[model samples]
Target: MENRQTEQAYSLYKPLLFSLAYRMLGSVMDAEDVVQEAFFTLYKSGSDHIHNMKAYMCKIVTNRCLELLRSTSKQREVYVGTWLPEPLVTTASDETDPMQSYLQKESVTTAYLLLLQQLSYVERAVFLLREAMQYDYDEIADIVGKSSANCRQIFHRAKRSLSVKGVSDTSDRSDLEKATNLVEQFMHALTTGDAARLMKFLSIDAVLLADGGGKVKALTQPLHGHLSISESISSVLKKWPGSFTCRIAMVNGLPGIVVYKDTIMWSVFSFMIRDGRITNLYFVVNPDKLTHVQ
Candidate 1:
């Protein structure tokens, strides 16, 4: 292939490749890894012939992410407790539009990504590529190495398998503003160590996931409901005897908070707000993932 043709192909397929990789890996860092590795393997490799360049490249990316995921499972298994996916971004508006986020909003909502968590890695890849990117069944089949009929069947199963908790539809400004405000209130409660204020913002069955990644001492199990989560947070703050500052920041394209020390990185929290209450909190204090803070 001529240099121009190869470059053009790269540009044309970049979005599609990122979408596939992101869906498969659920981490932008991992997605970029898969994409770059695929580019080198298929494009720079002199001996290999890439026929149907788009399909061929996507297959490489999907397979690479799957292999990485397979290898990473042992780490998750040995993890201190309930493992959650890393929150890659703070907001969609930083890179794309925020209005139709979960459309591209998997990064924003823990609920949406949690749905992917339920999928077997293959089913996750197929559903995300097809549902979000509009990849044809034939194309997905080519990438996954199955008949188109099988691809369709698998994707259908993936959809049926998803138990869409905390899922929301096309929310209007008033709705989004309401949720954003609730998050702000919750943050204020935490920052001030006000248990009474924080309790007002959480529902009875709300859950919190803290990902300190064994680097920092954090709750190993999902913190349940308003009382347990609130008392835990308030007690920690009271014991620490210092203010952990948080700023209104973009996380995965919705309202997010990046808690910090004196110019040092701390935890980041993303909200899952619904029915005027916080449904879930994804607290990411993992220093490895926090390096993405900009």
Candidate 2:
């Protein structure tokens, strides 16, 4: 009966726990592993004495992520090329999966996750719990084992840091529509090999960062300015002799492009739009990172 009850509890909270873990760690495999470990710990300890299973599970996952982050700090510092979070690819129509549902939320977008990466683990936990999960300061304190006042301070500090980066929690519908339309135009330009058309949609100061993890050929440094990026894209396309299929897909809850070569995911392009032009373009081509796309 206890085992059965624990299984039931796992089903009830797995989605929320996985969501929290993924947001905290920014790695799908690590998030899934942490979630499973949390539940296994819960099952072994039994849930009878637990007053709030959801909070308990969140605490476990958050603390585990903090530990993992600390251990991986050196790895990130030494990471080859530009580093990007593993892309959480989703079909535009698959709404039933809990992980998909959580990922579709703005908090899990690659851009937002990168901002969160700017924070310390404690600050990230407090800010995410307070901002993304909508937890109260007191609740956040409990999860992160900080005093309520300290959690409040951490949250404010984190918010201010993101503000310095021009982060906004709110999304405008018109802006979203414009972004989607721009992505469509960008894809069309890419397929048609129209360099001028492609350049038209990019911001003058646009930046492009590609992460290949040194496992594949990729830009070793960011490309700046519209003309540079435009020419780079044109040059790469010209070099390809074999035909590849490209399609606009919803990547990290925004309209993006996915390219497939020999039916395998070759690259994912996500953009950040500002003032009606693409301000930032993230190209993820590391094969290890594409393993989870399907």
Displacement of residue 247 (Cα, Å) in model 1 is 1.2
**Model 2's TM-score against the true structure:** 0.91
Angstrom error of the Cα, residue 285, model 1: value is 1.6
Question: With candidate 2 superimposed using the best TM-score fit, by how many Å does residue 26's alpha carbon deviate from the native?
Answer: 1.6
lDDT of 2 by residue, 1-294 (tens): 879978887878887887788878888888889999998998798888889777888889999999999999998899999998877777757778766666555466678878878898899889888887788888888999989999999999998888435543225667667788999999888876667889999999999999999999999899999999999987787677455678888777777899876777799998887777888899999888888776
Residue 14 lDDT, candidate 1, scale 0-100: 66
Q: Weakest 10 consecutive residues, lDDT, candidate 1?
A: 97-106
Each prediction's TM-score against the native?
Answer: 0.86, 0.91
Best by lDDT: 2
Runs in model 2 deviating more than 4 A are 164-175
